[model samples]
Structures are given as C-alpha cells and as structure tokens.
Target chain A: MKKLINGVDQIVSEMVEGLVAAHPDKLRAIENTNVIVRADAPVQGKVALISGGGSGHEPAHAGYVGEGLLDAAVSGEVFTSPTPDQVLEAIKAVDSGAGVLLIVKNYSGDVMNFDMAADLAEAEDITVKQVVIRDDVAISNPDDRRGVAGTTLVHMIAGAAAAEGKSLDEVEAIAQGVADNVRSMGVSLAPCTVPASGKPGFTLEENEMEIGTGIHGEQGVERRELMQADAVTEELVQHVLDDMHLNDGSEVALMINGQGATPLMELYIVARKAIQLLKDRGIHVKKTFVGEYMTSLEMTGCSVTILNLDEERKRLLLSGRE
Target chain B: MKKLINGVDQIVSEMVEGLVAAHPDKLRAIENTNVIVRADAPVQGKVALISGGGSGHEPAHAGYVGEGLLDAAVSGEVFTSPTPDQVLEAIKAVDSGAGVLLIVKNYSGDVMNFDMAADLAEAEDITVKQVVIRDDVAISNPDDRRGVAGTTLVHMIAGAAAAEGKSLDEVEAIAQGVADNVRSMGVSLAPCTVPASGKPGFTLEENEMEIGTGIHGEQGVERRELMQADAVTEELVQHVLDDMHLNDGSEVALMINGQGATPLMELYIVARKAIQLLKDRGIHVKKTFVGEYMTSLEMTGCSVTILNLDEERKRLLLSGRE
Candidate 1:
C-alpha cells in the first residue's frame, strides 16, 4: 500500500545510484545505464565476468560483484532483462584482452540479449563465452523444465575461477561443471513483492498459495494448499532429491533460500528437516548454506537447492578465488 | 495464511538445528542448547564475541557466525529471549583465557537475560564485559532507546575487532563507540509473523502501516496513513537524523532495510530519494546499504538507519579481519 519511492519508474536507476554512492571503493555505476562495474576494469590480462537479469534479485547479479564475483552487472527493471544495448555497454566496459564470460540464467529474454551481445562483441574483435544455468529441477521436462534458483552456484564457481586469472576455456568449463551439478526448487504460500510502481506485486487469497513458483512472482505448476514447513519441505526436497538423481549414500551441498517474506527461523526449520530427509536416504551432505541468496521481491516462501558435489565441485566450493 | 511449521513452539529450536546442520564447517550448534558457535572459536588468545535477541533475525545471530562477525550466538524462541542458561552456555563454549565480550541489543528482555548470564559467568571467574546497543533513533529517551537495525553494525564492528585479536577491553571500547554513533528507525505497512501456533503474529489492513515498528512485531508508535517511498524515507530518515541529533554536513552510513515483504528495488528507490534529501540538507553520505538485514516476518515495508562515522569508525569498518 505505502511505499518510499520517488517514481514507480525510477526505482532501479535510483537504487543503482545509491549503491555506487555507498561503495565507490568497490563499485562504480555507468552514467545513465543499469550497469555497475568494479572501479578496476580492463585489467589488461584477466577475463572479465559479466552478469545481469531482473532487478528484484538484488545482491545476486550486483551485490555479488566484488573481488570474487562479477566484473560488471547490468540490472533490468524489476523481473525484466536488461536491454541488449545495456548488456552491450557492460561488455564494452569490462572486456579485457583476455575475453569476457557471460553468466546467464535460462530465461528466454536473458538468453536473447546476452547472445546478441556476444555476437556484437565478437564482431568487435573481443572474444566472449556464455554459460546458461538451467539448474532448477522444480520444472519437470515432461512439460518443459524451466530455470529457477540454483544460479548462485554457477556465479560463485565461474566468478571464483575468473577472478583467479583462469582462462575463459577453464572458467567456462568449471561453470558448466557446477551448473551440471546444482538443482533448485521453490514454492510460495503468499505473494509479496514491491514493484517499482510502489505497489505490492501480487496478493494471495488468505487461504491460497502458488506452489512450484518462480522468482518473478509467476504462478507455479499448481496452487496446492500451503502446508506445514515439515510437510512443505518434504514435498520440495523430495522433488529436489529426485531431480538431482542422488541415490542412497550420495553427498551434496544444500541451500534453503527465502523468497523474501519467509523469516530466518522458519528457513532454518525447513532446512533442518531437509537435512534429515537427505540423511535418512544415507545421502552424505558435506556442506549447507541457508539465507536469502536470491529472492523474489518480498515474496514469502522458501526454496531448497541441492548441489550434488563431486571432487571438482567440492574443490570449487572451498576455493575462495572468484 | 499458509505456513511450513509444526507446533509454533518448536519453530525456533527446529530452525536452530537446521542452521547447525547447514554450516558445520562454519558453525556448530550447542548440544541440546539453543546456541550456535563459530566452528573455529576461541583462537589462542582472542576475545570471543556473542550476540542474540529473538529468533526471527537469522544470518544474524546464526548467519553471522562465520569468519567476519560473531564467535557465538544464542537464539531465543521467536520474539522471545533466550534463557539465561543458554546465554551462559554460549559464553562458556566460546570463552578463552582472553575473556569474552557480550553485545546485547537494548531490548528489555535481551538486556536482562544477557546480564543474568554475565553475572552467572562472572561467578565462575570468567572476565566478561558488555556493550548494549541502544541506537534506534525512533524511540525517545536515550536510555530507553530501542535497539533496531544499527545493532548489526555493533556486531560487525566489534566482531571485526575481536577477530583482529583486540583485547576484551579494546573490543568493548570499539563496540561502545559504534553503539554510540549508530542510529536506526523502522516502519511497517503490516505485521505478519509466525507464532508457534503457525498463525500471523499481528494483522495490518491493506494501506495501513505501523510507524516506528519493533523487531518482535511490537505495536508501532502510530498507525499513521501510508505514503510513497519518497515520503516514507523522508519521515523515517528525518526521525533518525533528528533523534540522533545529526546536523548539516554530517557523514553517515545509510541503510534502507526491508521488513521482509518489501522488495530490494523499492528499498533502493527509497534510499535514492533519502540520499537526495540528505544531500539537499548539506549532509554527505559516505556509505549506503540497502537490503533486508533485520526483517519482521512477511511485513511489507522498509526501515532507514544511519551510523555517524569518523576516521576511526570508518577504519574499523574497512578493516574486516578474519
């Protein structure tokens, strides 16, 4: 109902300005653009990492830009892809002689823009590589598997490798490795995101929820009844565990992220059961991370992601490079 | 409303267990106790740091337990204080011969339980000092000020010093300086938290917001009419700036934190205008952080906090030790 914004339209631009004002030491905002870059760019020898997507997934495409993550991130309006020109400018800003790697989520618009940018940049004599993360197991391909929440792993693995001066070939390889291993699934009981319009995005009836939801406030596969955390987790994790194809005695890394409205306490409760669910199957979970890594604008629910780790993923998980 | 919880009473305990399971390398849950400790606490002769309040602020007491902040944290049930015994156990679990420093938010229940633990720990010859953060500028009476979002700064600044191996007294001095300089104020358009019974904690009709809200879903100072983000930030920042007694040309670290339900884009938009408002008044903002640091469960709104900064405070902030 009530909001603290100047214009419904200027929300993203305004936020970018404030972030630059706050972290000049770590970042800089391009004039009149949705791109934020590290103060140090075109390092002459290292591959640059570029990422961007909708604006609502804060700290995701941008907050993660620092020493170990993205070199530049172009932000679109809430839940929308940055235009091709915006992505093109970002590529121009961060591209070094070493080439640029575009970390893309498997969204149609995102794929189109980044792919176009890659073609443009390559035409300009700058080499570019792109990786599309389709790690969300929530969507079954019986209809069509869609991308959801596991993109964080791809970012970390690729960003870490890029920051370490790894070759584009090596970085893309590691990103592919991580992407192949991670899977995410989400469900929401209520819809609560404040769009740039200064209005809450969607409203769920008092007794309704959109289950198997996506981060953009998109309706899920079904609006199943919202149940207890344990029961919800049981259904969610079963989907993830089965999707990951982890059998008894498998080892993994789990992330239980809030879609905004879920509190810290309940996230932990859900994650606690998720661990037991895995343990009961003799699946050895080596690591776990729980928090709002990537979120839908103030939506209240939690998603569980399991990264079935192998020797390579385990090494990259601990590797603090990017 | 849909929820993912068993009996409401078991929410906090169950969540704590999940956090423990999530980050065994980074955190360890106290056996049969509602406390969490950094896996590598009590390094040789470093002062241990512990902070906790209610259960809703995650990655807070628990989320912050890794490398940069907090050696240990004790969580109370949702909106409740941890028992004194739990505090004592957390203190003992992390206390080295170098002693421990307790950082307590100035909530009445929090103060009493932490102080009770201090007295209990003192009886056992453990040297302990306390820094009570009462920085919410929204509340009147400095002594009666309610600690809000700025309390996180206390934990971080003190946690940095402690990790850098500052003596207990030195850490206390730095934490006190942060506690003295920081101020926070919160607003909410709704009140919906999970009670152990898995029901909404408080209800706010659409278009109604509780101004000057509290962390545990406390009734706000005024059920005033809600407005745009620009107006919201003006009211909240003005409250903080005035109550903190900051004048023109003051440099502060600004934060526009969501109370769960508000989106980051909207929060950033608000921060944009708030920054403009301050600049117009001749104040220089040295830093800005916009996200959901402390949240009211599923409430759709944002809060603003400012921490006055000097060279020393800035140094302490920039110097984040392992």
Candidate 2:
C-alpha cells in the first residue's frame, strides 16, 4: 500500500519503461511488450543469453542485461511468472546465429514458462537450450528448491560464456555446472506486501524472524525468535556449505545479498561473519560481492550465496563485462 | 529494533572490519583506528582525497575509497562526527608528497572537526585544503543547508581531479565548484531506528511521509500525506532546479538515491519521473545514477540530486576509475 507505483497493473510495464529509458544505450524494451533486450542484441555468431521472472526483484534479470550478462530479460507482473509468449519474444529478440540459452530459476512457474519459451523458439528453427537453477539450500527436496540469489551467478557465468562466442551446448553445460555448484539460503526479518494485494502475504510477530524464507514471502523452514546477526548468518552459511559439500580448502565466490529493505551496513555485518566463518573452516574466498542483487519487495532480511569455483567457473564469473 | 547487529557500541568498528575483510585487495583499515584507506595508500606524487562523516551512512566515506575516488575515509560513531585527531590521522596516513584534500559534509560537527583537522595537518607540515559541501536545497539559508547525497558527486569529481594529478588548489577548486553547483532533497516514508537507539528516531502514521528529511533522520521541511510517485518526484526535481537556477538546455548529472530501506523498484520509478520531467524542460542529462549512493540507516524513502555540470565537471564526474 505504501509503494510509490501508480497502479498495480502498470508496475511491470512502467518499470520496464523506466529501466530501458534509464539505460538507453545499454538496453531496449520491445515495443508494447514486457521484454527488455540489450540495445545491440542478437550479435552475429554469438550465443545469446536470456532470463527473467517476476517483476518485484529489480536489477536481477533486467539490470544484468549488458555486454557481459543477459542478452534479454522478460518480466512478469510482480511475483507472477511472465507469460510464455513474453519469454518467447525475449528469446527471438536476442537470438544470434550461434543459438540461444535460457537460464530459468527453479520455481515451478518459472521453469514451466521458460521451458515453453524454449519450445516456441525451437519451432522457429532457433537452436535453443535451457538450464534450471536449483540453488536454494533451504528446501529439503532438490526438485522443489527454489532459486534465489545464486541464479544471478548462473546468469553471470552463462552470459559470459555466451558472450565469448561459445556454442549453445557449451553455454548450457556451464550454466548447469554453476547451477549444480552454487547454494543460497536466506532469512527474513519481515514480510513484504505485493502492490496489487495491498496486504502482507504473511505476518510475523515483532520479535520473530523467518529462516530460509522464499523471495515471494513464502513460509521459511522455521519462524523463530530473532537471533544475533552472527548466529543467523552462521545458520545460512552452514546450510550452504553443507548442501554444496564444500569442505576445507574449497574456494568460492561469496555473495551477501539483501532481500530488499536490508541496509548495506547489515549486509556487511553478515558478510563479515560469513567470511570469518568460512576462513575458520579453511575455505578460500576468491571474490566477495556485498549488496542487493535480488530482493523481495521491501521484505527485510539477507541471503548468503556461495558458488564453488573451478577454473572455468571462476574465469567466467570474474569475466563480467559491466 | 529488528537490526542485524551484534553490539551497538561495536557497530562502527565491526562494520569497518567486515568491509575491509570483504575487500582486502582494494581496502584496508588503519590498525586500531576508525579509518579506511586504499590498500596502496600514500601513492607518491598523487594528491590524496579524504572524506568522512558519521558511521551509520555505510558506503559513503569508506565505500568510496578506491583508485579514483578517495584515498582515505575517517569514521565517527553512528551519526556522530569523527574527532579532529581521527581526521588528522587519516590526513597523515594518505598524504603523498603532492598534498591532501578533505571533502567534508556541511554538518556543524563535521565542519568544525575537519577544519580543526586541517589546522592540525598544517601544523605537521602536510599541505592540506578542505571543501565543505552544502547541497541540500530544503533549508532556506544556504549557510545552513546540509550536505546530503550530492556529496558523492563532489567525491567523484574531486577525487578524479586529484587522481589526474591536479594541483592541490585545482582539486580543491573543483570540489568546491561541484559542492556549489549541486542540489539535493529527500522524502522519507518511515523513520529509521539506529541500533544503539533501539527505537525509531521519529514516528509517522502509516499513510504519512516527510519531505526534505536529513540523512540522519533530522527533521525535514514538511510532514505530509504521501502522494503519487510522479507528483513526489516532481516536487523534489522542481525544488532542486529552482535552487540551482537551472534552465532550458542545462546539462546535468542526475542521481536518484534511495534512503537505505527504499527498494530499487521505487528508486527506478522515481528516476523515471525525474528523467521525464527534466526532458520536458529540455534539460540534457549527461549521466544518471540510480541507487543507494548515500543512505540513512534503513530509512524508507529517497533523495534526488542534480549536479549542473560544466565541461570540467562533466569530464571529471565521468572519470571514475572503477
């Protein structure tokens, strides 16, 4: 209700307009469509990369569209999956002769829609491949684990590979490699209200916090009394390390992500604990990113993602162009 | 307060520790001192640029320290100014043979303390000059205007000048010129709770908001009901334009800064409006930065900063070296 949008129906459209308008040289929104493609998309002989999902998470799919990232991003209404046609438009807009690769998060809706888009692209004789990122360590069922911040890492690695003129299969393999190695877990201090709903999806007592909350305000594994910053971060970090089988001497690229509404100060505090704990376990941190990469529409909390790094993965991850 | 912090008394120290830990290659903390310096500090023959303020504003002073932005940043406790000795220590640590330039926000504590530090540096035979940025337009008296987000512009420009090997006087003049030309104003949807204070700085009804609120929750010019996003952005943009005396064909760098808790979605909405309105007036936007450049600790709202640019500033502002 307190959101600064004119109407819930216009949130996605207006946001796409604003994003393309803000970065005219870097991005372009397809006419009358909720798809944003790089201004110079469809580079000849280069594998194109496309990704997208719900609208509330700004800078995730769209903000990453540039030279070294996604070639296109399709957006849905807030917290809702984009229609298959929208994804198809993005695919068609960015497909070069080399082919196209889609990075879909593991959410059921996202996976279904992106897969349909790939099918549509294939019908047009466009060579297309897809990888579903299931990186959240919170869910016990691997098939049910929803992608979180770690999906951004997948986009970076896969996008870089595509930008390097790799074959569609090569890009797909790297995307899947990142998907298999990355793990993320989040904690929420409060719930977020979708603009259309104007009501919180869920509620928590003032003294309680949710561990492993979904980006859309889905119930976490547990809601418990708030703990200190280090303790909360320790829980998420341990979950990720355990889930990924990262042991002593493992190297990683750490992402300390704020789930919308969390401040950089708190994110750094969480990062401090994460880094210290990882060091204690003799894990080497190759790179550290601390900021809001993915968000949950003003929900308060943080997520920690660790991408186990190999030479190829590290090269592509660090190869971000912009 | 639902903040992710351990001890309020240790927040500043711990945050700095985390920052340096995460960016060990780029930054380092002065041992036992609340100061962050570039890892390769005291670059011979390069004018050193330093800035600092209260600790709560993460990424302002410290985060800006890098190759082409700042050489050193001193930190005070939360919402408190660093003492003169702390500033003096920063000056000493980063003073190359060329000189040192101090960029101080126009808070009473900061001005007095930095001036004292400048005097201390002179006593120690270190060539030092200072510029106090006054960019907020809400206050009627120019002398009383508080430096808000526009201080970042001063840093970018002056630091670039210093890094470009400009003379001490040249860098000071450029910084002062930026401070004089830039204008900023903010609106807050909710009050922030400082960790040590464990309570909101001020309270607002659910539907209420504050215009021209200071970065540290200082009282703004008006407390009013929230309006549509465009209308709010229009008011801020008009105020800044009026204060800057900008007109048709003016070229400027626009910054849509989110006060920590505001989501990027809202910031982009605000940026959309700001850009459209400026274009309506035939103003040419040379560059646009939309993000949490400077922030109030988890305060929900945003600020708009416009730096009317001349050729020198246009070049220097765009001269950020990573």
Candidate 3:
C-alpha cells in the first residue's frame, strides 16, 4: 500500500483540515467533527443542502460544499458511513430558517445513518427532509442499486434550486426528481485499499476487469478479460441506456466519472465513445462532464452517469451560483 | 500494462477528439490537426495564447483552453513534442489581428518547435511572441531544470491577461514574469506506462520513492525509502522554499498537483503539510489549488508549485472570465 497519507487514524481529520485550509474563503469545518460547511453557511431563509459518505471520494461531498452546491458535507472513515452524530452536526451547522435537505447515497449504512440524523434533527424542532439517491443501475433490481456518481447531478441541480431560495418542499422535490431520473454504472480496472486495512478491497489478474462494480469495491456483477476502451464503454453505457429506456430524441446530461486513478485522457476517450453511443440511439447529450466527480480511492476505472432532463432541470443544471 | 485506451496509435487523436466532444461550447480542434482552439477563437483585438507539449500531460495545454485561458492548445504525441508544422497550424488558427503568444515548457523539443512555429508565423506577418517556462527547481543548476506543474500557473495568470485584451507584448511579459517567479518540485511513488511502450517509464521498489522526478519520469535527484506524507512534503517544499528565497510574510499562490494516479485524498494530505510548512516560515498563502492540473498518465505521485505573487498577479489570479 504505497499511499501518501500520514497514518490510518488521521487521514479523515487531516483531509478535512487540509480542504478547509485550502479554501478557507469558501469552506470551514465544524469543530470536533468531520462536518464541512460553506464558509458562510446557514444563510437565513434559504434551504440548506447536505451530503456525504466515506472520506475516500474526494470532491464529492466536501468539494461540492460551496455556493450553488452543498451547504454542508459530513465525512466518515474511508468507505464507511458517517455516524448520525456527525450528520446531525452537519444538519445543525447549515440549517437556516428555511430548513435542511439531506441528499444521501443509497448505501445501507448511509441510508440508515442519514435518516437517523434527520430524525434527530426534527426532534429538536429543525425541519429536516431526506432524499435517498439510488441512481446506480448495476443491479437488475433497481431497489437494490447503490447510489453513485449521478448523485453529483442531484447536488448541482438541487443545490441550484435551493440557492435560488426554493422552499424546502420544492428543493426536496427537485432532488427526488433528479434521483429518480438519473442512472449510473461503473467498471473497475483495479481495486482501492481502505487506509486502515492497507489492502485492496478486491484483486484482479493483470488482464482482467470488474464490470458494474460499486464505488466501495463491492463485488462487481461480472469479472472478465480486459477489453478495449470502446468495448468497456459500450457495456456500461448500454446498461445505463437500457435502464433509462429513453426514446430516440430523449435529451439528457452525461457524466464520465473517473474512479480515482484513471487519467483524464482515458476519461475523455470514454466520453467520446459514450456520446457517440448516445447519438446513435438518437439521444441528445445536452451537457457533458468528464472528470473524477466521485471516486473510489485510487481505483482505476470509470463510471457513466445519465440524467433525464426537463426544462426546469436543464435550467437549474446550467444555472450559476456565487 | 493495464490502461483504458483504444490503442497506442490512436491515443492522442482519440483523446483530443474526446476532449473537444465533451467541451464543444468551449473548444474545437483545427481541421486535420491535433490543435484545440477556443470554440470562438481568433478574438479580434485580444492577444491569442497558445501552449502545448507532449500529450501525456493532459489538461495542461488543452483543459486550460476556454474563456480566460489559452485561445488554443496544440497536442503532441504522448511524451513527444508536437512538430513545428502542427504548432504553425495552431498559430494560424487562433491569431487574430491582435497577434499571438506561445507558452512553451522548458523541454528542448517543445522549446525548439514552438520557437520554429513562432518564426514561421512571423514570416507570415503574424506578430508572435514566446515565453519559455523553466520553473522546476529540482536541479541545483536552474538553467538545466525541467519545467513541471508550475507551467499551469503560467497558463492561468498569463491566459487571463490575454483574455483581458492585453497586447501580445503585455501578455508575453506577464507570462515571462510568471515563468520567472514560479518554482516547483515533485515526488513519484510509481511510474506510468506510455501507451506505445507498454512499460512503466521507471520502476520503484515496493517501499521506495523518487524525490524530484520530472513529469515524464525523468530520473529524480534522490531515490530513497518511502517516508510519511509529511516528511516527503517537507523535503519537496523545503527545496522549493530554498530555491525561491521567499521571505517570511511573502504572499504567494500554492498548488498541489497530482501525478494522475494519486488519490485526491492523498493530495490534500500533502497539501496540509505543505501549507503548514509555509505558514511556519511566515509565508502567506493567498490562494491554493489542489488537483491534477498537469498529469503524466497514471503516475502515482504529486508536485508542489509556489508562485510568488504581487498585487497585479494576485488580482489576475482571482479575476473571473466567461
């Protein structure tokens, strides 16, 4: 495990400190907690948004904590869900008179903890709403799917709505709509190690890959011989397209997300194939994002996210924030 | 080597195609050339900026090609400089009546080819100016140091000047100033494989690292047992500090650039230590950037860049663009 961290126990705290230190004007950390909030959080009369998960996925929960995005982001241990207390702190730190919305990914631990945090918050007279994002289509059973990179779209669109001073209900509706309309699937060329474990969650032979892998290295649906970039992209995009069930003229936003270690060059190559695939099916890609929006430590792979877009969703997606 | 690429021959072109596809609103490729120009290039009365080098270092020249950045970015084969003719095409495509400026790295091939292209453009009556960025402080002999991640700062600061309607001379001078004031050093834990070669650029033992490695896996000044992130960061930052001779209370911008394969988590860990080291020296870090700006495929490492800042440079760095 040749990772560049000081120690296993300190990775999360140090990372939070480092992030706030780097962007002090934009973000700050809640005392004694792994909760990061916008520097000027708790804007009076504005719905506040919060999301987070394990610490390894950089720029996901915390990176999105700023104007036009998340109001607060809680951090757990790597690949571990945050405690309800941590999530509760995030809720308190960002909730203004308007209320708080928790955008949580659909991992069992995450769902339970965020829900518990919302309950805890509501008990204290804080209006808290929660939306579970289950956008990953890796499993045939949609109910069993894990949320993945499509959650980023939810943050962007819903965050914009909240920033525009939407009521808590309106923001929740926008978030749930995005969660319902988005789908994502990923392939991992390699696995990532949790800092405490110092060993990869899984392993593969030199010439093999795991398709439809979860961000936390959950067992993938299939392990196959390595294929060309186009073939792999085809498999992932086909799964997403089939699940979305869009007609020829369906318009959508596309995101090609790198799984930690993949190069931007390869992500672009993947994006090119994905766009071409969508065009062939008569799907219009209105907005395209290519980068590591969410990641699984230093795993080498990528995910494709497609969000069915309407006028409001498109407008909010493209809207700017301070 | 395990990589998500179509093939060695098509890697550069495909990557370029993919990049432009993902950002059509902001970038376009010159017909039949590997040059990517701002979608609305040749902005009359605004100095056009051009930068390029080997292809492996992505987002270096290309990703920076949007509003407030380079007017055009020329792509070369992986780790190989683009030919003078290719650069000449870039010069031709983005040169409005306001003239053009070429930002070339310190590599011999890049410097030679960009200079040749400038000469060719001058012959065609296009006012062409060039700035050769040599910001790496790894080698004690500054004249022989290779340019590293600091080139990205040159692009950001100088590119903004060009976008603000600065003349070729003004942009060239600002670029030259940035080039002179910036310094960088890097450490690599693992080497990346070139697509054509299908072999790691260099190798490291299971618990070893190379301090002061160049972007292309050039031999580092020191190779030793792997140390904690803080220790490694101290070595790199100390070298940069000593080279820059920044006084206590000096204001500057700092960047922690990932070398493709390092996780963002690790980069922030490194950033925390770097920031503390600078603060302890009374150096005031006005702005900090953390991510992969210029990458070497999938190398597992990072580089630290510090740019001495003045009022003009700080304002430009913070300025906005469409």
Q: What's each prediction's clash count?
A: 13, 0, 0
Model 1 chain A — which ten-residue stretch has the worst lDDT?
A: A140-149
Model 2 stretches with alpha carbons more than 4 Å out: none
Candidate 2 displacement at residue A68 in angstroms: 0.5
> Would you give me the overall lDDT of model 1?
0.79
lDDT for B293 in candidate 3 is 93
**Each candidate: RMSD:** 2.6, 1.1, 1.1
Model 2: which docking level applies? medium
Off by over 4 Å in 3: B320-322
lDDT preference between candidates 2 and 3, better one:
3
Residue A134 accuracy (lDDT) in model 2:
84
Per-residue lDDT over A242-319 for candidate 3, one digit per residue giving the tens place of the 0 to 100 score: 888699898899999999999899999999999999999999999999999999999999999999998899899877
lDDT of 3 by residue, B1-322 (tens): 8888989899889999998888888889998889999999888788988999999887787998988888889899999999999999999998887998888888999999999988999999999998888888888887888888998888889878887888888888888999889999999999999989999989999899999999999998999999999999999999998888689889999999999989999999999999999999999999999999989999999999999998888888888331
Fold similarity of candidate 1's chain A to the true chain A, as a TM-score = 0.94
In CAPRI terms, model 3 is classed as high
lDDT of 1 by residue, A57-163 (tens): 77677877777778899999878889988988999999888999898888899999999989988999989999888866656772245456678777777777777
lDDT leader: 3
lDDT of 2 by residue, B254-295 (tens): 999988878788888888889999999999998889888889
C-alpha positional error of residue B7 in candidate 1 after TM-score superposition, expressed in Å:
2.2
* Best-fitting candidate, scored by DockQ: 3
